[model samples]
Target: MANVQVGNGVHRKHAKNQRSPEESVTEHESTSMGSDYELNGSTNTEVQTDKYGFIGGAQQTPGEIDDVPPDVLRQREVKWLEMLNSWDKWMAKKHKKVKLRCQKGIPPSLRGRAWLYLSGGKVKKEQNQGKFQELDNQPGDPKWLEVIEKDLHRQFPFHEMFVARGGHGQQDLFRVLKAYTLHRPEEGYCQAQAPIAAVLLMHMPAEDAFWGLVQICEKYLPGYYSAGLEAIQLDGEILFALLKRVSPMAHRHLKKYKIDPILYMTEWFMCAFSRTLPWASVLRVWDMFFCEGVKIIFRVGLVLLKCMLGSPEKLKACQGLYETMEHLRSVEPRYMQEAFLVQEVIDLPLSERDIEKEHLSQLRRWKEARGELHCKSPPRMHGAKAIMAAEPPSRQDLQQNPTIIVEASQGHDSNIENGKRAKKSKTEKNKDPNSSGLLNPYPLATDQSQGLLKEGTLQGSNQSLSSAEHDTYL
Candidate 1:
């Protein structure tokens, strides 16, 4: 047997004290847990492994097994495979069904592929074919690379993949984070991203993981991993405000103790609960998070507070800030079980509309208290489905439509054909007062043009504004 250090600093001996001849020859084969364990000589010790490959006593923690019936899992896998094959149609016509399925759970076998599809990582990879390779080929900035190297061992260290120092798991994690720094030098790297990227690597390959991290940092949660983390701070305020309605008792307790939401929630929200929730619940929450967006995160937080501190009896142990923080950090296992947490998140009344309304209110309050925000990038489209919905018409679709207007942003002269100005005939120009030598047959009335522009209908052919932008067009 060989001693192996698993995640969280626990050490376990190999399963068998002596390897058979066949076992020795096939030792390098990948396991169902998605990692290859290397043997280091032999000893007489033995230990058991969990379904997820956590060894020894670490298996006592929750989420160690697949609780779903084999038949149910098979059926869900079939449905998910069908949805993935006709993803565009499902997203366009049967989104509710997709949401319902994601809420129930994504099959373990299909989770990696599903996450790539749901995060629009697949689409992003398609758009920028060789971008990750380009970034990977270059040596990353020393500032970020140095910090990233230090944090690599700390991410899921007990997991089989990352257990060995400089192992493939840590190596892939390094590539993803280092590539990100080169991709967006200004933002650099955030320590919080390491664990998030580690979770992605567990499911997908390194290239897919890089794009998934890109979608997460840039699209799913804009401005979140920035230098000051101003966006997450703003979201903390929004979460607290929403807590008042979800659990007034919990709100009162925090307010009475003067406990800032950021103190407890920074890790939870920043890592999307990867460090806080059990392994199974984290996957379930992430399935919904990548499908629906950050609202799922908010709901999970609100549910935790409501379950842990919503009542006077529950709050008895949480008499002060220290106790409250301690309780939050070491949450009782019962409160974090996948079935319970998923149902609570699903039943919660929180919606994206509610989050946005509170976001605006918080923004106004922040400006009043501390002037303008540093990061003004507009909010991103929520979820993988929203990203897919906002995708511009495909090149083939554009090529088929000859009369479509050329967007000015694409370095095209909107009014020119070939190398010359496309002038309208004098008779036609005089017949339609609103005509501007474009393809629009139903030209807007003089008074309607400004309103139409304000409404965003006049932006451009290729522009794909988010639903929020459409709702708040000005």
Candidate 2:
């Protein structure tokens, strides 16, 4: 009877401790280390401990970022440089072939940097950024910047207006030229830069183009637009003289008609013939120009006149003698470049020698033509009694290296123009001459010139490319 009573008490205790199966499962999920559940009634992916230490519904990602090696990146760069250099050799060889046909060479896509490097300019852009940060450290930057800033739009107003209107190449040219003028003040401002600047900006970034302009001015086309404008005038006279030699009849016709090639061609030499050709052909000429020098310009100009004027039949039908020039100007795009490239006419290697000789003769002629004026290191002039007498400066007098001054009171004291050229008409010659502004033969603008002259504070072509390309062969 005692044993039965104890067993009944134990059975009652076990029943009290037991839970329903669903409640047991819920409690185990909510509290157990190996499982999870939501007490707040929101569904979510649960975190739980497992043999792996921690597990979640989220998937694991593969591998660390350090797995790739850096040597591979360096190797790829070296390979690319090799390929570019090999192609460079290919271009050089084709350009150098003596009897090679003149064809429209493809404009280098690397034109902007090429222009700079070829011209002897540095183009590392990071250099510009660091240079900018060090601007305060550079003492003369302010004045140079001011001078360049003033000419920015003045040098390129048409471009400025074009860019503001969202035309493609114009803006790039403006920025590059402007930045470069800012970068190098020794070449502060000059004519003939506009079109070349435009061309460079078309192919490369503006800053790179800026350095290119520098290279051309500094290295390639030396003394072209320096203070005296002597280089441009000298080249022009040389071309004119060469034209007369090449085609006497045409030169006579031009002379008889009082046709000034200088008027039409000034635009050409000033910008290195860039204005006359499609951008690519001009660049091809530039490629040769880089390899050669000023002589290429003369050679090219000689050949151009030979083609345009070689035949009386071709030239005689024009209404005026000047009409031939107009025709050359108006030649269809296809024929113009081909006319320039033809080998039978241009004969590059043979012509290159002649051009060099011609260049020497031209220099001698200039020395004879202008006497002491062609000398780059001009003798100093002091306004002494001899200078006041208005006698030509003696070479011996200059050898002593005395500082020289001509009568600044007379505006043409530089002798670039004779005092006679500056001599006012009889009525005004004796009157106050100093009052007259110094006569600049090539004043920056003219009435016939575009009348826009605003101060500058700021700162190329393309497609229609293929038709322009094939035209060089004709």
Question: How close is every model to the real structure, measured as TM-score?
Answer: 0.74, 0.49
Please identify model 1 stretches exceeding 4 Å from their true place.
1-47, 56-66, 392-474
**Candidate 1 residue lDDT tens string, 1-474:** 234233232122222311211133344533222223333222323334344544533322433354789778756765775676567778889989999999998887677777888888877777787998888777768788779888987887666666655455666787889889999898999999999998888776778899999989988888989988889899999999999999999999999999999898899988999888877788899999999999999999999999999998999998889999898888888889888999999999988899989999999999999899997655676776678878743433211111124333433345455443434444555765654445443334565455435644434432221111110001
Q: For model 2, where is the 10-residue window of minimal lDDT?
A: 456-465
Candidates in order have lDDT scores of 0.72, 0.42
lDDT of 2 by residue, 1-474 (tens): 011110101011112112211132343332221122232232443333221111221111112212214344323323322322332332335434311211223233233333443343332332344442232223333444344334434332222112222122333433454445455556555646766676565444445456566656655565675677776666676677677778776576667767666655666667877656543356566655544455556666666666666568756755475686687566445434533453433464434445446657877887786775542632211111112122332223221110112233453446546566545443464563433333322222242122211111100000011111111110
lDDT of 1 at 92: 80
- Cα deviation in Å at residue 189, candidate 2? 0.9
User: Clashes per prediction?
Assistant: 3, 15
